[model samples]
Target: MTGKRGRPSVSEALARDERVVDVVIALLTGDGIEALTFDRVAAEAHVAKRTLYGVFGDRTGLVRAAIRRQHAYLGDAGDGSSDLRSASRAILLHLLGDEAVGIHRAIIAAAALHPSLAQEFYDEGPGRAQGFLASHLRAEAAVSPELLFAALLGEPHRRRLLGLAGPPTPEEVDAQVDAVLRTFGLLR
Candidate 1:
């Protein structure tokens, strides 16, 4: 939608911003961080370069936005999770998905050169996951949310990160979650 004089309405601007971030994520997952640039993203997103700068400030900001968006999508699965078991399973499944793995690979590749981006990735991804689990663990008394988060991902996530494995099926994810919950004595 456009307002007076052909200016984009607020909703249109936000939609365009989302489109730009989607382009950024695609670029990142396809070619890593090096492929992310104002020029290329502007062209791929079909938006003005100035708009990218205006909204994201610079390359780091753009990267941050993309990472956050990906994390949010992954975290959404946990929104309806009420108990520890459901939340743990949802978080594990979401984190093990292809997009999550690709984002993880991209961040790891950029970590040494861009420490801030690495930190951003941790905060948005694992940190948020840990916090999500923590909320559900409030009644577990002895269970450590951080440890549970680690255990949930464990070797499966390692295999995915190394490209030695594909996304696990629901049954596999359920088994992994049950095993981890059993280890924590939290399975019901």
Candidate 2:
């Protein structure tokens, strides 16, 4: 990811770009936003500074790209029956993972300094994740799947983000899922 160099050969750019983003995420998780700079990221990523600038245009762009990369872990679309509790559980777990938590923190910290960047990250990331999850719930509809989705995808996760709670344990997740099922009359 050495960003210090001029343009790489076409084939090398894709891999370098990925490495740059990966290095940025690693740096972000280790140190908060204040500690990041193009020079530091170039050193950390092992890329030439010039190359980094060529790809991202500026430090702000790099920050945006890195945040976008972390959030993009949630996929574009999903296809699963809402009735399939196991699949639903997996999605919930992914959202609450430590890595996801780190990304969420970085975005929040960055947002305090840069509102536009935060907005871009939200539009590119969480909104997409919610839409993908919403679509899956739509597929799962035995009936009133949105209600189930709302419960499963709602307060608990955001409450975790607000530092009001940590990720729920598997037992707790099961209870939450079960509550959704009972409320929707999916469980006997």
Candidate 3:
């Protein structure tokens, strides 16, 4: 019997996409974005180059898809809680996590040469996180969500990027989250 002419079943397609993104993330973390090529991704992902082209079109599209996949946790609404502090802590935790730190380093290094990727990263990663936090904050708060996020990340994030320190421990993340929230008057 003949089968569908185009694409696999939805489940299979999703699984393939997930695998591709996972491979991309691993490459980015291990070798930085400069080393992430479609050829390499296809070889490692065990998907045909044509399949990657069909799903992602090109290197940029594949990188963007990978970034979007990594940002999925940031896109999630937490516990349906209205508390800004809770939201802030969740955002900080995700942002400071090991995977996020690695992706951030890759994006920053990639963006130095590819300016367009900077905008894409901002829109999809930090921009989304900022919007999420802003939605949970009081309108009258003097601090902007962007600044709040920066404060939450602070020097530790920079240190991580520079290979001067490892990903912050959960206690460190909570402390920094509290400090930033307190500074912004989001926490009592």
TM-score of 3: 0.86
Clashing pairs for model 1 are: none
**Model 2, 69: alpha-carbon shift in Å?**
4.0
- Of the candidates numbered 1 and 2, which has the greater lDDT value? 1
Top TM-score hit: 1
What are the per-residue Cα lDDT tens digits for candidate 1 across 1-188?
Answer: 65354568899989999999888888888999899999999999988898899899998888878767655634544465477777877777778888778878998999999898888888877887788887777574577778888989999999999999999999999999999888777876
State each model's C-alpha RMSD to the native. Answer: 2.9, 4.8, 2.9
Judge candidate 3 at residue 85 and give its lDDT. Answer: 67
- Native-structure RMSD, model 2: 4.8
Query: How do the residues 25-114 of candidate 2 rate in per-residue lDDT, one tens digit apiece?
Result: 776666866666889889978787987888898766777787566455344455443434664565566666565666667778888787
Q: Estimate, for each residue in 78-162, the C-alpha lDDT of model 3 and write its tens digit.
A: 4455477667777666766677778788888888798887787788788887887787777798989888878877887788778
Q: Arrange candidates by lDDT, highest first: which order?
A: 1, 3, 2
For each of the candidates, give the backbone clash count: 0, 11, 0
How well does candidate 1 score on lDDT at residue 176?
95
Per-residue lDDT, model 1, residue 94, is 75
The lDDT, on a scale of 0 to 1, for candidate 3 is 0.79
| Candidate-wise lDDT, in order | 0.83, 0.68, 0.79
